[model samples]
Target: MTSNEHELEDERALCRYCKAPVPENEWFGLEVTRPVKMPDGSTSEVDVDFLDAVFCSQEHAALWLAAPIPPTVVPQVTVFPRWTRKLQRMIERGRP
Candidate 1:
């Protein structure tokens, strides 16, 4: 194989949960959109690739998914935040 091809094959992604090296050919994960509240009170949908949190196998992915979400340590403030339609309806109904 050419040097470039060999380099490409050596590329690996670390699994998010186990931190195991996952080769490029064995990368397994999900592509998700995350909504970020901008400073202008607008939300943007960011397309995230598997590289952000890749997995070596489906079991690892499942384990990661089933794990409890940890509380955020960073303090963030969202002023005049943009709310989704469902949340808006819930607010109108006086439901927290």
Candidate 2:
């Protein structure tokens, strides 16, 4: 691998659950293995080839193990969805 590529890989590690870049100090690693079936109809153990993830914190790790990360909150919208039919209905009802 190239030196620059190696450096880039070292600098950025995304959390497996939230997909957030983990800080240097907050770098947390986890390894996992899974079973897979080959096309030949045989089962084999498969180990992840690369770093599984670098979590932001221990809490995130625990939460990730329990469930998938929830999507981030969207504070605003640029274009109206479905022509803003829902909003229009609410406006027509004189609510929000």
Name the runs in model 2 displaced over 4 angstroms.
1-10, 39-41, 45-51, 68-96
Q: Write the per-residue lDDT of candidate 1 for residues 27-89, one digit (tens) a residue.
A: 777544445555575655652212245898999887887775332232366545456676788
- Could you give candidate 2's per-residue lDDT for residues 22-84 as a string of tens digits? 776766776544444454655545422222556878887777767753432223557668768
Worst 10 residues of 1 by lDDT: 43-52
Q: Lowest summed lDDT over 10 consecutive residues: which window, candidate 2?
A: 68-77
Q: In model 2, what are the clashing residue pairs, if there are any? A: none
Clashes per candidate, residues 3 or more apart or on different chains: 0, 0
**How far in Å is the alpha carbon of 24 misplaced in model 1?**
1.3
**Can you give the lDDT of residue 34 in candidate 1?**
44
